[model samples]
Target chain A: MIERALKTGGVPIASMLKRGEVKILVVEDDKFLREILVGKLEKEGYTVFEASNWNVAQKHIQGDRPHVILLDIVLPGIDGFEVLSTLKRNRETSAIPIIIISNLGSREDVDRALRLGAKSFMIKAHHTPQEIVDAVKKTLEEYYLRR
Target chain B: MKLRVHGTLFAKFFWTLTALGTIPMAISTLFLYATYESRIRHIVDEDVARELQLNSGIQFLLIFLFVLIMATFAAYIISRNISRPLFVLTEVMKRIAGGNLNIQIRVRRQDEIGDLGNFVNEMVRRVKEARERQEEISAVKSEFISVAAHQLRTPLSIEKWAYNLLLDGDVGKVTPKQRELLEKAVMANESMIRLVHNLLDAARIEEGKFGYTFQKMDFVPFLKKLLQDRTVLLREKKINLVVQHPLPRDLFLTADEERLSIAIGNIVDNAIRYTASGGLVEISVDTAPPWVTVAVRDTGIGITKEDKDRLFTKFYRGSNVMHIATEGTGLGLFLAKNIVIAHGGEIWFRSRETEGTTFFIKLPLEFSPKSPSVVSHDSFVGSI
Candidate 1:
């Protein structure tokens, strides 16, 4: 039934990506993690691109308009907080939902990210790669349906 | 008949001095009274009036001396009893202040001072009990860490080997269903390994009694194995490493193989963390006669001067590193320092903010069989 609804147009269940493509950008400094996120999201049929730092993420956004971003709080140069804020401030990327996937999930960080237009914030230890993919898909679909 | 200290020679002497001063005046008054009475009797009437006046003067002197003696004895007894116990109590207070709460002051009387001593004893008992409770709480926390470390690794061991088995596809090519589950398991297991590592470190640090087994090992083959084993893990970041040589083909170093590997591994892991994708983490080895050293340099965000000083201390996270990443238990560097020190080596780092960081470890080339085992002894004392 979920597959049927998703294949039709869009599912109200906010889980339409199980059988569909949902483009995603994974911004993280941890290479090991970037590979896993890219692999898992790609397997789940989401178009996935990688960025090791804020500079590459900015570059990626200029070309491809991803539906959702998996942002790591700690990055190479500019941290994820700055990246999230910049993305939210831009008109073109403002509607593009973000989910902070990071080792920093302190209440203050989560609250800050949420205020900066992140759809959700998740701690890496608290969620698996697959869960992150699931969350991104759900949040994107929810944002779409709400809009 | 009782040999009384209260009415002893000193008390009598003090009283005599008082008596001597007052009695002379009393005698003169009496003499004047007698003369006045005799003159009055001669001038006007009576033997009776003179006799009565004389009797009153004698009685007054006798009563005054008696009261003076009694009061002097009472004052002596009062000062002795009150001051002696109070002085002893103050001395006991000093000892208690010096952390010797073990002394018991014997208060023979059931007076206020005895009650005070008992109250002090109760206070000491309570303080000692509170200290014991704190020690017990700390012990429980350490025990929990150790127990949790051991327990966590068991599940990890099971899941790790199980995933390996499943990924090997002995049960046949995995369906998407099976793949998804195994992927989650793998992810969770990795996190679990990190948690266990942190818990073990915390427990060991708290216990100050880390169990370590030392054995002489070859450095060359160990380094080779490390480089080979971590290639895939490092490939995730696409980071490259350059190994520079001043090392022999197969250098023999007398040290605990496991501990040395862990220490080097921590440094390598930290380098990997700091080096961005496409950045370099360089490993170089050099010798200074009796010493051999390994240096790891990363092109990641570096440490400030103040941060560099406190880098290897327990729970110390550098400002630059902290901004880049979180979830560090901050025990790896501390453990690495301990391991290196145990091998009679020195560990230090050089870093500049935004430039990058380089950590160097120096170990003695020759290990004396009599390496004192000083660390273990110190650890034992600390545990106590």
Candidate 2:
């Protein structure tokens, strides 16, 4: 799934993928935005899961153990920073490539997220849905290459 | 308030006068009286005694005058010593009140006046600290604005993506009229994204966070891709975008490609935005030893004489263009100049009102082999 996308300019929609494998968990708070993102990712032929808050995100993270995590910084409880630090600390989930989709665009925040082991940081309003999908695919490709 | 003396100058003056005048007069008069007392009785004659008394009286008069002169001199010296430091303290207060915080009183005494001097110094320091705290708070506020601009982009990004989907027919195919309306919305969304991005960038540049990543890259592909990206704008405006220089197959330049793209893109975009329909914008380059100069000349409604001086100033929209284009935030040229200078380059422009404008960006042929940092270390020409 990842290799095909990487070969074709990293367009997630163009690359065919297996349904059960290559799971992506999206953790976002805004219901409309979460649905839009979920719709975009599902259209790209990937198995997707949604978590509206950090607690739900944690349950999905520990139980499903998704391949890639599309995380948002601002959440209802225990924001993205805390969630990021927690996942990165765990032995099982540490290898999962997490990309931060956040409204926190300050240099300090970006540097902090990157330093905490996020694969990439995306400003929510700055990127289109398709671009975000591409970012997910590119990050997945890079993660596999590193492994 | 009435003058209250901590240490009395009057007392010093009185003591000086008593010591120099009264004491000396009493001693001299007693000695003179003692020497004449025995001789006056022995003489016994009335005339001789009276003559001797007169002589003693004249001597006393001379001694009194001498004592008075010495006393006045001593009083003057004592009074000056007491008042000189007070005069110095008054001058120091005047300076501190006039916003000079650097001066400190010379606390040479351990008396009440010395304590007063130290008190003044402490007050000045507190004032200075308060001013510094005010400055720090303002800095934090500006930093907050920058961070807020970043946060503002998220919603804008969502809107942008949503609109783009509709325009691309991701949801469903639409009629020609609906497509045109959706396209307008897409353009508006794009403008918002650009604005938010520019605001964040300008704030970062102001706070010295916008840095450079130097890499060895071919300039030919970079410029080609940069211009090709803006083909839509050229098509929409029907402007003839010309590349004057035939780019070599391999034109290598040591620079930061991302920042250079923004800088050059801003210039070309501005050219397209301001120029009327069917105008010309030409991009050319000149290569010489140690310098590679890129020039962008636009046949736009050129800058006015008044606006030319402040063209690159942040948030300074030209009066002429304000009616023509209300979309600009006036940060593009300012940011472009900073990025170019950050790469050890210079940006200069020449324009005539209603004629045209030509902006030239000159970068060094070589860069420092190490990481090239930002250009906000010193105040630049574009800074307001």
Candidate 3:
């Protein structure tokens, strides 16, 4: 149902390119958190796609690639680390800035996610939705400036 | 009266050698006398026999002396050989009993003493394994707490965002009365979030996973800013919070600012929590070369004698304050002590029941990160 919604609701690639609207993909397992994040990102005037797990996230990336990806560390089957490494290794998705929003606040977890090529790491409980939005904006600005 | 021999191995060996020598000497002397009297007396002249008897008597005396000397020498060597290793073993055992698990008994011999040394080594190895297993179990326990706390935090984060959106009028328009209630809910939710964070930190400290990123920072303004953040709490309790001036602005220290803030903030929070309305809580800093001490004094219900001993222990609450405030997790002082000690610092308190309590945190100006094993071990001792 989520994949079908993504297929139908997502703007066409040509229109998105023509409009130059920034697209954000949120990969989170929790439904309410995903909704709030998606809601916040949509409210911020960005086209947001929600993924409950890595498979759905992979479909979103392949179908209509997002400009930025908000990744969660813990997920069913393949974790965020796997998804991050795979994306970083791939030439196509390597440039897509991925910011990790996780419940795991350990130094090891943060360092690991960053080392695996996450643009930034945010602890879920420590940051509000607004702060996360700020981080996304900052990460995107840095990404564009570096380019 | 009975002669009570102290039954030492040395003494036993000496007596046994003496007995062995004396018994043979006594039998030889009796046999020589019998033979000289029965056979030699009938065949030899009186003078010659008498001279022979005297010569034999001297020979026996010389033999007895030689045997006694040999026995004493042999017994001394044997006893020394046995007692020396035993002495070394006793000392090593004492050190092992004193919680030094890394020492090993070196054994070169293939005898009973060597067997004993090997046994001690095996025992120590097993003890070290058991201690490691215990540590692993503790790490697992900390991991459990960490994972559980993270799980709790996810929903709490969702709740926090939901509340934030509601308060920010993102969902809909909120009334003034509704905003006030929502703010209270936010505070309560934040406290719950803080509690989860504390549990995570405590677990990390236990598992020696608490990361420290130390940098040179000014101590005075850092403290002033921290106190400024707590002014609201001080105002709410109507407690007079004071920071003694003339605190050197150049009092620099190498510290993890985020962690040190939490440690100091916990101390200040505890002072605010326990202090009654219209009470005084004073914070002061004193620098003496390499050492900088921060003293937080509160004029509130002081620690009882029973609670003083375990004040820095994990999950410990004072007898007097438990009824007064039930919101404490009893982890603040425990965490404060661990963080302070991790920075090569010390934390101690002086309190008198029903009067007040003053906590002193003494930190080094230069933080030389001790090995994690040593830091965790020290914090473990502090927690216990």
Candidate 4:
């Protein structure tokens, strides 16, 4: 069903979000999952950045400003919750919309992530790679359209 | 745990009986004294009557002695009647607290003590049921390592995505051999998805999400069709699958066909799974008044005593047959047991090591007739 949504109406929205101008930072710990997400996001014409751990994620966020961030809760060094709080605390990254794509499916975790200023929460297991790409596209459109 | 006695049963019984015996005796003794006083007044002069009054004092003392003796006897009998059962009840309670749920105090009377015994029995049953529920939840939690949906599902999602990418030829044009290898990968990925899906269903079943859709239907045809489908497995193993009885002409039942099918299917699958090549499997149905019993007997490697004890426990693969067949997720029989139990039925098995095994499922003709919902369909992993 999500695939149908992406196929029917995703292209125009992808163009409208200015795929070339948009930058998305994916903060995930798993190497294989990172590659899959990167491949999907890059295919959608967005400038995608990757961070495998908390230190790299911190460095990347401080040096480069991305319009949106796809954050995962489980990480190698400092966990995703800490990363979420750090980014939300900073003035520059606080305005950037974060969509959590993690395997933490409990209601408590989802509520906590949303309360910590995430734009959306998607369970990694429930969605296809393309659907996640569509989420990024939709979040960007909503972010820009609001301004 | 300390047992709390609500009221003093022995004291209550002793006091009630003593009062019953003494009250009448006191009244009768007073009447005899009154009659004796009148007769003495008529028969004697004033001086003689005074002496007669002294004699009547002896009669009063004798009556008091008799009443005391009778009250003591009655109190002993009454207190014994209550105290014996109470002693037995206390012992039974101690046994229960020590984790023996099968003991029941013999109820012999229609008194309060009998009611207490019955109440204790009911309490033990409820405790046993609650313990079973707790066991299932903990088993499911441990099986998935606390995050069931996330653990298997994330890997399945990644595999499916990767397989889809390969099929789409996004990376490069695939050669013929590469396409064949990718197709195998797709098949393997699908099986992994199915396995994860089954695990999710088992978790849902543990979580008490049995979506049953009960309907009135003929059960004989359903059983026949189910067995007919199993012919493939039977032939592959060269096993003789026998139906012991002709389909009952009047076998109508009210059941959730899908869930019941899955439950029975799991048993039949086990029968096929454990049976050696060229073995025998028999299916039979018999009626014992209000219940219908379905038995699946297989002349295969039977369950060991240790395995039988843990058969219904979740994710419990038998230690004896671990090397025999290693593909099972150990959730099939657990799911079947719960499904049968939820349908107001009973499931058990009889087995002798190295001989054979027979599983029995008993279902009542009438059960909870509440309208069934379709929500449980999502709990199933593969196609029904």
Candidate 5:
């Protein structure tokens, strides 16, 4: 279920792309998971940006901002929900789809993140980095059609 | 009327009692019709001739008898008037007792009794409204808790896994105290997670907002399959589970597998916990008429008679069981009983003080699965 939801939600369309390039951002607190996500995301033929916490995530959003964020619900300072909510609220980052990649897989949790405008929610243990990339790619593809 | 002999709520032949009792009165009235003015004078003759004639008292007795009958009829009408609203109020009380907080005692009359009924109705309404609000807040609180729990889980998992990764020398070796601290942290995090899950589950169940999908599955094979799945854990405990399956290999019955899993899981786990080393846990099936029974008998620290009475009660930690096990929250049996009752089933048990105990669950083969009735629990959500 997690993999499927992620696969459907992963894709991020870099707005300034030459109708080809896809840019993805991976935001997490743990250095290990961050490394794992970036390695696989980079291998998937897209530029990937990494942030250890919400501060760095904000920096990435402001400068060298990617099209979509693979945001973990847990971060060092401000959490991922706040970041996702801020992104959705801000006109500049609002269009960039947010996928909540976290281990919190409870139905209520999923419902909450989705209600907070998260494109989708996925539990980490069930998904590989490739699936997240696929999720981003798929989400971007779907959003491009809407655009 | 005549006193009722049985358990019936309403009585028949009430009108006949009135008619039977009215017969002589009717005859006397007929007699008076034949001699109208003279009979009227004779009936009240004692009132006209009191202390002057003793026989005149007989006519007076008749007049008084007529008035007594009239008063009895009038009393009936009055009692009926009082009973209608009283019945309505009783029905409202029944609804409240049955957990239907939304029912109101609608009394429009301004009499003292009516006012009392109206007051009670309004009180119930306010209570229902307030309870609905409390329920709403609890739901929102559950939602927030669920969300917060999920959000917090990611970091906690990362922290725990990272600590595990650290302690296991995936990254580097750690000191014994450091490892111990991480272990404590992991344990605490686990407890917190469980607490959140239980609290949310309880709130959802209470609010009647939870969804369940039921299907038919066999009992013995189901346990067998679950045992196979938990073989590793069972092996660690070194305790054997003997299931005497006289039931059909594919005994079809209607239920929600997951909920039943949780229910039976609690029983099995309780047995596993309570049974000392080398002790056996016996799970058996009894297919009797009117019910099917699944029993778990364990050679555990047997429960006291007091413990037996409140075993399935929420937050009740048995004295002996508590001494043996401290890690449990005492909510599993509570949840199990709740789910079982909801499934139109009965869960009960028998216990011996120091020998052994057996818990039994008898579920209907088929039942009218309780459709979630419109309740304060529903409006509880709506208001929020």
Candidate 6:
């Protein structure tokens, strides 16, 4: 049934199978944006996990490591920078490609995100859901190619 | 205020000099007279002694008058020297208090007065440093505004995406009526987004954090692409956009493409917005050696007399266009001006109240390497 949905979505079957094996963890506090991102990613045939905060994100990371992480800068308990550094410092989670999806579009913020080991930075408002999904796919492709 | 201090200093010096000169001279004169009277009384007869004594008294009177005059003159000279620099220093301090931080006291003397001059210079330096520090703190405050604007854009983006998704039939097929309302909502959301972006850009420009990347580009294609992007707006308004290049060759210039586009785009957008439907916006490029000029002429409601002086000021909207286009943030032209100037170019306009407005942007064909992509905040402050 999932394959049929993927096929109807117009993605090639082989690529869909490969994408289905890839897990993406979304770390966003805003419920609506997170839902949209998750829906878009799932429709693109990727296994999606949602985390509203760093702790939840940590749990998802330990249980079943995601192939890619979509991180947001603002959070309730711990901020995105700390989460990014923690992920980068740890040997296991460091390899996973992290794409920052946030509304903080200042040059300084973008520079800081890139400097902290994010694979890509997308201004949440500046990009549509499809564009963001494309970014994820691009980051995943680059990650796999490098491996 | 000036006279009292001057008088006090003069009086103090005068009395001190007078006392020092007069008291010693008077006492010595009394001793010399006593000795001379005794000697003359012993040496000569009464008539001779009397004549000599009168002569000596006259001589003493003359010397005393000369000493008094000399003291007064020396005191006047010394006091004037001391008070003149003090006067200059006081004036400079008042100017500094009035918010002029560029003044520096020139010290010529090696005396205490010169030391005071040096101190005043040091004080001005410290004040300038403090002002810069305060400006930096305010820059941080503007950064806060930038962040707040970004936060505001987040939800707006969500609305934009959700509405777009519905319109595109991603979630379900949208009916024509539903699509029309959604389109209106999307346009409103997009305008809100534009306002937020403009606010963020204004904040960045103020803080001198608006980054630019310069590259050599062909001006014609760049301009053509920009006009192509405005097709929808042009079609909607039924405005005629005519591009004219008097020169047959392509105009080449070094610029930060994105920034220059915004600057030029602002003029074009303003022309379209202010002009009536079926009006003409003519964009023409003319080149003289080492200089390229782009003139945007519009058949629109021109600038009013009152708004003429403040056309490039932030948050300035023309009184005539306020009712016509209420959504203007008044930052477009201001940002456009700054961007153009940062490129080492000039922007100006000619307008009459009822006829039309024509904006001219003059740029150098060769971008000087001395002024890099990022313009200094001091330069911006001076421009305003």
Best by TM-score: 3
lDDT of 2 by residue, B1-384 (tens): 787444567556856686767676678777767766776657578777667767877877787777677766776677666677777777766666665666666577787777887787788779879977986886686688677776667667667777867866778988899988878887787787778778888877876778677899899789989999999989999999999858656668889898899999999998899899999999998888688888999999999888988888888888899999888989999999999988889998988878788999998878774464332322111100
Candidate 6 has a TM-score of 0.69
Better model by TM-score, 2 or 4?
A: 2
TM-score of model 4 (CA atoms):
0.48
Off by over 4 Å in 1: A1-147, B1-136, B154-181, B304-310, B313-316, B319-328, B369-384
Judged by whole-model lDDT over C-alpha atoms, candidate 2 comes out at 0.80
Ranking by DockQ: 3, 6, 2, 4, 5, 1
Interface RMSD (Cα, Å) for model 1: 9.8
Q: What share of the true interface contacts does each candidate keep?
A: 0.00, 0.73, 0.77, 0.54, 0.15, 0.65
- On lDDT, the candidate that comes out on top is 3
Candidate 6 residue pairs that clash: none
Tell me the alpha-carbon RMSD of every candidate: 22.9, 12.8, 9.9, 14.0, 10.4, 10.9
Residue pairs with colliding backbones in model 3 are none
DockQ each: 0.02, 0.43, 0.54, 0.25, 0.14, 0.45
Worst 10 residues of 4 chain B by lDDT: B375-384
Q: Tens digit of lDDT per residue, candidate 1, span B219-263?
A: 878987877777986898899988886457667788878668888
Highest-scoring model, DockQ:
3
Count steric clashes of candidate 6: 0
lDDT of 2 at B109: 78
TM-score of 2: 0.66
lDDT of 3 by residue, A98-142 (tens): 999988877788888889899989988888999999898776656
| Regions of model 2 farther than 4 Å from truth | A1-22, A76-82, A106-116, A137-147, B1-134, B137-141, B168-173, B215-217, B248-254, B367-384
How close to the true structure is residue B94 of candidate 1, measured as C-alpha lDDT?
Answer: 73
The true-versus-predicted C-alpha distance at residue A131 of model 1, in Å, is 28
A75-137: candidate 1 lDDT, tens digit per residue: 775667887888889898887878887654434567789998888887665555556777876
Angstrom error of the Cα, residue B252, model 2: value is 4.9
Task: In angstroms, give how far residue B48 of model 3 lies from its true place.
Answer: 28
* Candidate models: Cα lDDT each: 0.73, 0.80, 0.85, 0.76, 0.70, 0.84
Per-residue lDDT for A72-128 in model 5, tens only? 886766666777788888998887889998875555667778988999887764454
Candidate number that wins on TM-score, 4 or 6: 6
lDDT of 3 by residue, B130-216 (tens): 999998999889989888998899889988999998987998999999999999989888888888989998998998778998999
